[model samples]
Structure formats: structure tokens, C-alpha cells
Target: MRHAYTVETVRAAERTLMSRLPPGTLMQRAAAGLAAACGSLMHGTYSRRVVVLAGSGDNGGDALYAAARLARRGAGVTAVLLTPDKAHPGGLAALRRAGGRTLPPEPEAADQAIAQAHLILDGIVGIGGRGGLRPQAAHLARTARESRATVVAVDLPSGIDPDTGETPGETVHADATVTFGSYKPGLLIDPAAEHVGALRLIDIGLGPYLPPPELEALQHADVAALLPTPVGETDKYRRGVVGVVAGSERYPGAAVLAVGGALRGGAGAVRYVGPGAEAVIARYPETLVTSGPPSKAGRVQAWVVGPGLGDDRAARQAVAEVLGSDVPVLVDADALRLADRDQIRRRTAATVLTPHAGEAAALLSADRADVESARLAHVKQLAEAYQATVLLKGSTTLIAQRGHPVRVNPTGTAWLSTAGSGDVLSGLTGSLLAAGLTARDAASVGAYLHGLAGRETPVPFGAHELADRIPQVWRSVHPRT
Candidate 1:
């Protein structure tokens, strides 16, 4: 699992590590890593043009010292100091000694350096910076975007909220970010994540000093450990059956896609109940279908409710019956709208709610734009409000449950944004829940597998193709010995 710590946690860890080391030791380590990365970006050190946007903190020192290293190696480096008077004294002196020149934040000199430089290192602000960039820094960011140089941010891109992944104002768009010590939440979550083109973590021995992560993302090995494996004694019932209540006459395709997803999710059998019975049977003849309510849909280890289920009387009845069952339930799509909030909060069994930004916004009574901008905060709030595991899907798929580290899915692609994708996800997650995974585990694992499948599928594909590819991704994660 890849872990992301908050700014406070990172600061605490840095303080602890800094205390044990001699003065300037950590900065030297950081400078070495940053300089090595900058050197690798260039074809050769000789006569290479590099520009550094240095601020007034340790982050500025990191950039300035790195520029000095490059200058000593025959690169012509220049520093554009946003805070000329407050710039790191040691870093400024080092750069001058190594033949690097300093330029004030004058538009002319700064513009000239940015336009002609091969690379630009952003160190205008550190993790403690909140809101947006200052006027000078914002201008540099805009100029850097308009320039031909490859922009590399130090620690993090300037103007991003390190703790919440929120970019309240103008932020630098980097070709890549070289973060020190550990991953920050803003680097992994989006709008800020979108600005961070590529991410590279540099270790400065802060791991042992850091506390538990605020968020985590699972990799192949972690998913492999969590996936359920069938034993010799495991029969169809023992392996688990997932009950799906989805689709309407208006959108029978929702039922078919959801059932397809459940079938691929390691479930021994899938029992589907809804108005789309005939359509589902036509596509997946193996599905056990019923026109009755979910309560009469035979025994199931878990229930998935609300994909294309309209707000009709029967839909409400079906949702109520399923919620009444003493089994885990996954709520999605139109069902998120039709189901009673009180009942959802009152459920005895585990519940997982999957919502895209708009659906999440409706639930929270907030603007969708706000939810999208502050995804980390909204997902956490939704999880706590409903007392259920919540999966907020978008550029970054996040799974949050109260009292646990929020999970960010790193495998998602924007191509997975097609129609009925959420339905397929609901079915797959419900099947995992049936297989005895906790709501949190089920949602995270389902998202991980679904995203991998989406990536594996050819572009411009439909939701059905996405569902078909799940087992392939699953096997890749948990291969036979």
C-alpha cells in the first residue's frame, strides 16, 4: 500500500528527524536528490540552462542549493527569488560561489530566464502554504505554463493545500513533482493531483519517525492478500451468493451490467431481482432471476440495490425489503435517491454507498463543484454522516469509512467515466461484501479491480466490456502458483 500523510504529520516527522541530525543535514540530503533529478532531466551538464523559483523557506533552500550543484557541474543556472530579502542566506551564498546568478522577480528577467531555460524548478512555497499563490508566484506559474521548459515542483506544487488536496487559487502545473520524505495527501488526491503530472518520492529517512498514514492506496500485492480464495470444501453456497436489485423497464441495461459485474467478482452465484429480469436472463442465462422483491429472491450473502431503479412504488418496496435483510448492502445510482436516509443510517448490517460527485452532492446538500474541488473532505464527511463506507468516484476514486484511513484508488483512468460504470462497480463491490470482506475492504478492492479492468479494456468501450475484463485483472493480481 502507498501511504499519504497530512502536512501536520509530515511536519512532525520532519521535526523528529531533524532533531536527531546535525544542522543542514536533511537539507543537504534533499538538495542531493533534487539536483540528481534535475541533472537527469538535462542531456548533459555543460552549458545547460536551468532556472530556479526560490522562496524564503527550506523549500527555497532545496531549490537554490540544487541550482548551485548544477552550476558547479557547468550548467548555467539562475535563481528568480520571489522574496529577495528573505531568501535562504546559506543557499544564496552557495549559488553565488558556484557561479549561479540571482534575478529579482522582475517580469523581464524572469520572463527571459523562463522562456529560454531547459528546466524550471518550483520552490515558491512549501507544504505549509494555504490558499493560492501570491501575485508574484502566480505570475511565474503562468509564465512557466506558457514556456517550453519542463516544470518540476519541489516537495509539492505551489498553491495547493497539502492537507486537503484543494487548490483554492492559481497553482503551478508541473511536468513532474519530486516530493521528499513521504507522500502528501495533496499529491495523491485530485485537483492538485491533476496539476501534479508525475510523482516521485525521495526518502530522507523520515519513515521511522512518521505516524500512521491519513490515507492509503492499495497495489497488486495488497489486493491479492485481501481477495477471497476458494477452498476444496467451498460449495456454491459457501463461496457466497450476491443478490442484485437493479434496473427498470426504462433502463434494463443497468441490471444486465450490474449482474455481469457480480458474476466476475468471485461470487459462486448471482441472484438478480428487478423489472429487467427478462433482459438480464437473455444476457446472463446463468443468473437466478426473480420478479419478486429481494426478500423472496432466495438466500444471498449480500445485496446490491439501486442501479437504474427508478423512484416508483415497487422500487421503494424493493429497496426497503433489501434494507430490512440482515445482510450487507451496497447502495448506488437511482437507489441512492429512492432509499430512505433514516433506514440507511439505521441498517444493522454493513452498508457501502457509491456516489459520483453529483450524487454525493445531492446526498450532502452541497454543490457538486464544491464536492469535486474538496473531494477528500466531502468523502470523509459522507462516510461519517451515513455511518457507512462511502466510495466517491471521479478523477481519484476514494473509499472512506469512519475511524479508518481513507483509501484512494491509484489505478483509475478518466476513460472509465462512461455510462453504467457505476452500476458495474456496485455489483462487484456487493459480491465482495457477500464474500465476507468488510465494507471498507469490499469497496476498496472492488474499485482497485474495476479500475485495472477499465485500463485493460480498449478505449471507447462500453460498461459490459469493462465488466468482462475484471477477472483478467483479478487473476493478474492473484495468479495461481
Candidate 2:
């Protein structure tokens, strides 16, 4: 798993570790790793001119010290000080000793240095940086970007909220980023993640001091462990049955797509109850299709409701019947709007709500832009409001429930934004719920598999085509013996 720590936690860990070490030992350790990563990127094939964009914090000091190492190895190194007065005294002196020169943030000289360099180290702003860059620094940063040199950020890209991944202003778009101590939430999420090209982490031995992660992204092994595998004695009913309440005559494909996802999601059988029964059976003959309320859909281990479900009176009744049932429920698409918050809040069984930004905005009574920019805050808010596990799907898929650290899905592809994808995801997740995983586990695993399938599918593929790729990815994650 990829764990991301909050800025406060990282700083606390650093402070505790720094207390036990010599004054400059931690900085030197960080510098050594940063320099080595820079050297690897260089590959000995350039004019060997390197420019360091240094701010006033230890982050800039790290860059300056690393540049000194490069200078000693014959790279032409120059530092552009954003705040000369507050620069680390030892770092400034060390660079000079190693035959490195300094330049002011004046446009002509700094931009010239940036233009001729093969690499630019972005230490202008690091962790805790917010808002846009200062005019002089922004000017130099623009020039560096305009240049062909590879830009590498220290810790994280400047002008981004390190803990939230929010880009409040113009940011440094780096070709790569080197982070120290541990990964930050900003590095794993978007807006900020978009600016980070390639990420590298260097351990300064702060592991033992850190607390539980603020966020985590599931890896292949983690997903493998969470997947449900059937034993030889298991029968169709013994494995699990997922009930899908989706689609309408106007949107019957939603039912077909939802049933497809459930069938592929390790369920023993699929029980589909909605207006799309004819369309579903035509496409999926194995499904036990019904044309009534969800209560009479037979003994289903879980229920998935709301995809393409129209706002007709019957559709509302179907949503009410399913929510009133005593079983795990996945509420998606149109159901999200129809399901009462009080019903969701009072349910003893697990409830999972999957909503995109627009859906979430409706639930929260907020602007879509606000939800998009503040995903973490909004996801948590929605989760608490409904008292259910919430999966906010987008560029980054986040699973949130009250008192649990959010799970940031790393496998999502922008291509997965196509139509009817949410319906498929709802069915797949509901099947997992019937398989007996907790609300959080089921949602996390379902999203994990869904994202992997999206990434593996050919671009421009239809929603059904993406669902078709689920078993392929499932096998890849936990391959057959």
C-alpha cells in the first residue's frame, strides 16, 4: 500500500528524528539522496549546467547542498536565490566551497541560466506552500518551463497545498519530484498530482516515528488479499447473489451494463429487478430477471439501486423498498437523488453511496466547483451526512466513511469518465458487499478492481467493454493457480 502522511505528522516525525541526530546529519542525508536522483536523471549526457531555484526553507537548503555535490562531480552549477537574506547559511557556504556560483532572481541572468541548463531543481516552495508564486519567482519559473531543461521539484511542486492537493494558484510543473521522509496526500491526489510528473521517495529514517497514515492507496497485493475466492464446495447460492435495481424503458442499457458488472464481480448469480428485465435477459440470459418492486426480488445478499432509474413514481418506490431492506445496499446514479438521507442514516446494514461531483453537489447542496476543488472535505462531509461509506469518483476515486482514513484509488484513468461506467461500478461493489466484506472493504476492493479494468481496457471503449475487462484484471491481480 502507498501511505500518505499529513504535513503536521511529517513535521512531527522529522522533529523527533532530528532531535536524536547531529545538527546537519539529517540535511546531509536528504541532500545525498536528492543529488543521486538528479545524477540518475542526468545520465551524463548534457551541457552539465544545472540551475537550483532555492527558497528560504530547509527545502531550498536541501537543493543547495545537493547542487554542491553535483558541482564536485564537474557539473556547472548555479543557484538562483529567491530569498538570499534568509537562505540557509551553511548551504550557501557549502555550495561556494564546491565551486558553485550564485545568481539573483533578475529576469535576464536567472532566465539565461535556466535556458542553458540541462536540469532545474524546484526548491522555490516545498511542503506547506500555498497560493501563487511571487512575481519574480513566477517569472523565473515560467522561463524554466519555457526552457527545454527537465524540471524536478523538491518534496512537491511549488504553489500547491501539500496536504490537500489543491492548486490555488499557478504551480511549477515538474518533469519529476523527489520527496523526503514520507509521501504527502498532495502527491497522491490531483491538481497537485497533475504537476508531479514522476515521483521518487527518499527515506531519512522517519518511519518509526510516524503515526497512522492520513490516506492510503491499495496496491496489487492488498487487493489480492481482499478478493473473495470460492472453494470447491461452494454452490451458486453459497457464493453470493447480487440484486440489481437499475434501468428503465428509456434507458434499458443501464440494466444490461449493471448486470454485466455484477455477474463478473464474483457473485454466484444476479437477480435483476427493474423495467429493463427484457433488455437485461436478452443480453444476459443467466440473470434471474423480475419486473416488480425490489422487496419481492427474492433472497438477495445485497441490493444495487439507482442507475438510469427514472424519476417516475414506480422508480421511487423501488428505491424505497430496497433501502428499507435489511441488507447491504449500494446506492448510485439516479438512486443517489431518490434515496432518503434519513433512511440511509438509520440503516443497520452497510450502505455505500457512489456519486460523481454533480451528484455529490446535489447531496451536499453545494456548488459542483466547490466539491471538485475540495474533494477530501466534501467526500467526508457526504459520508457523514448519509452515515454510509461514500465513493466519490473522478480523476481520483476516494472512499470515505466517518472515522476512517480515506482510500485514494491510484489506478483510475481519465478515460474511465465515459457514460454508464458508474452503473457498472455500483453493481460490482454491491456484489462485493454480498460477498461479506465490510462497507469500507467492499467499496475499496470494488473501486480497486474497477479502476484496474478501466486502465487495462483500450481507450474509447464502451462501458460494457470496460466491464468485459474486469475478469481479465481480476485474474491479473490474483492470478489462478
Candidate 3:
């Protein structure tokens, strides 16, 4: 799993690392890492021109000192100081002593330096800065951006809010980011994450003092462990069965997609019970399709309700019946729109709600932008409000259960925006739940597999293609005999 620590945790870790090391030792270590990365970018480093966009904080110190190292190695280095008076004094002197020149803040000067340079280091702001870049910094950053030189951010992009993954105004776009200590939430989460190209971590030996991570993304191995496995003595009944109530005359494709995902999932058997039984049978003959309500769908260890079921009276009845079931329930698509938050909160069995940003906004009575701005907070609120596991879908998918650290899915490709994809996700997650995975595990593992499938598919794929790719994803994660 890839874990992301909060800024408070990062600062605490830095403090601990500083306490154990000699003065200036940590800074030197950071600078050394930065210089090494810059060397790799320039291949041999000799005769190469490098520009450092210096700021006021230790982040600028890192860039300035790194420039000094490069200058000593025969690279022509220049520090374009944004805040000369407040810049790191020790770093400034060191750069000059190593033959690196400092340039005054001028648009023409900055633009020329960037254009002539092979590489540009963005040090305008680090994790400390919030909102966006100041006007001067913005202009210099834009100039660097327009240049042909490769731009490398010191810690993070200059204008990105490191804590919230937000960009208010002007931001520097980097080809790569060399971050210290650990991965920041902003580098991994979306909006701000989109601006950060490739991410590399430099261990300053601060891992000991860092607190538990606020969010985690499960890797292939983690997903493999969470996935259900059958024993030699286990029967079909022991493995678990899933009941699916989805689709209607108007949206028969949803039933096919949902059942396809469920069959490819870990469930022993999928019992399809809804209006679109004929479509489900036509597509997946293996699925036990029945033209009955969810309550009379024989027996199932878990239930997946509301994929394409419209706002008809029968669809609402099916949702109410599934909610009354003692088995774990996964509510998605149209069902998510029709769910009673109060009834969901009172349920004894585990209930997981999968909603896109728009559905989440309606459920929380907030705007979609509000939910997107405060994704972590909003997802947690939904979990608390409905007393159910909530999965908020977006670029950075968030899964939250009460009293557990939120799990953010980071593996999806943009191709997942295709139609009926959510139905497939619901079916897969419901199957995992039926197979005895906890709500949190089911949601996280389901997302991981679904995302891997999306990435494995060829571009411009539809939902059926995504569903068909699930078995291959499972095999990639867990090779079968």
C-alpha cells in the first residue's frame, strides 16, 4: 500500500530527523539528493545551463545549495531569486562561492535564463505555501513553462495547496517533482496531482517520527491478499453467493454489465433477480436469472441493488426490500439516488454506497463543487451521516468507513469514464462482500481491480470491454494454475 502523510505529520518527522542529526545535516542531505536528480536529468552535467527559481523558505535553500553542487561540477548555474532579501543566506553564499551567479527579478532576465537553460528548478513555494503563486512568481513560472527547458519542482508545484490538493490561481507545471521525506497528499490526489508530472521521493530519514497515514492506496499484492480464496473442503455454499437486482426495460445493458462483473468477481454464484432477467440470461448464461423481486431471489450472502433500475415503483420496492435484508448490501447508480439515508443509518448489516460526485452532492445536500473541493471531508461526512461505507468516485476515488482511515484508489485510467462502468464496479464490490471481505476491504479491493482492468484495456473502451477485462486483471494480480 502507498500511504500519504499529512503536513503536520511531515513537520513532526522533520523535527525528529533534525534533532538526531547535526545542524544543517538534513538540509545538506536534501540538497545532495536534489543535485543527484538534476545530474541525471543533464546526463553528464558538464557545460549544462541550470536555472533555480529561489524563494524565501528552506525549499529555496535546497535549490540554491543544489545549484552550488552542480556549479562545482562544471555546470553553469544561475539562481533567479524571487525573494532575495528573505532567501536562505547560507545557501546564497554557498552558491556564489561555487561559481553560481544570482540574477535580479526581471521578466526578461527570467525568461532569458529559462530559455537558455537545460533545466529549471521550481522553488517558489513548498508545502508551507497555500492558495497560489504571487503575481511576480506567477509570471516567472509562466515564463519557465513556456520555455523548452525541463522544469523540476523542488518539493511540489509552486502554487498547489499541498494539504488539500487544490490550486487557487497560478501554478508552476513540473515535468518531475523531487519531494523530501514522504509522498504528499497533493502529489497523489487529483486536481493538483494532474499538474505534478512524475513524482520521486527522497528519504531524509524522517519516517520514524511520522504518524499513521491519513490515506492509503492498495497495491496489487495488497489486493491479492484481500481477495477471497477457497479451501479444499469449501463448497459452493461455503464460498458465498451474490444477489443482484439491476436493470429495467429502458436500461437492459446495465443488467448485462453488472452480471458480467459479478461473474468475473470472486463470488461463488450470482443470482440475478429483476426486470431485465432476459437480457442478463442472453448475455451471461451462467448467471441464474429470475424474473422476481430481490426479496424472493432465493438466498444470497450479499446483495447488489440499483444499477439501471429507473425511478419506477417496482425499482423503489426492490431497493426497500434489499435494505431490509440481513446480508451486506452495495447500493449504486439509480438505487443510490433512491436510498433513504435514515433507513440506511439504522441498518444492522454492512451497507456500502457507491456514488459519483453528483449523486454525493445530492445526498449531502451540497453542491458538486463543494464535494470536490473537500473530497476527504465530504466522503467522511457521508459515511457518518448514513452510517454506511461510502465510496466517492472521481479522479481520486475515496472509500470511507466509520472509524477507519480513508482508502483512496489511485490506479484508475481516464478511460473508466465510459458508460455502465459504475454498474460493473458495484457488481464486483458486491461479489467481494458476499465472499466475506469486510466492507472496507471489499470496496478497496474492488476499486483496485476495476482500475487495473481499466488500465489494461485498450483506450476508447466501453463498459462491456471493461467488464470483459476483469478476469485478465485478476489473473495479472493472481496467476492461476
Per-prediction TM-score, please? 0.98, 0.97, 0.97
RMSD (CA, Å), candidate 2 to true, equals 1.4
Per-residue lDDT of 410 in model 3? 75
On the 0 to 100 scale, the lDDT of residue 204 in model 3 is: 86
Off by over 4 Å in 2: 45-47
Candidate 2 lDDT score relative to the true structure? 0.90
Q: Could you tell me which 10 consecutive residues in candidate 1 have the lowest summed lDDT?
A: 37-46
Per TM-score, what order, best first?
1, 2, 3
Candidate lDDT (C-alpha), each: 0.92, 0.90, 0.89
Tens digit of lDDT per residue, candidate 3, span 127-166? 8998899999999889988988889999899999887677
Error of 2 at 90 (Å): 1.7
Where does model 1 exceed 4 Å of error? none
* Candidate with better TM-score, 1 vs 3: 1
Clashes of each: 0, 0, 0
The clash tally of candidate 1 reads 0
lDDT value, residue 323 of candidate 2: 94
Model 1 C-alpha RMSD to native: 1.3
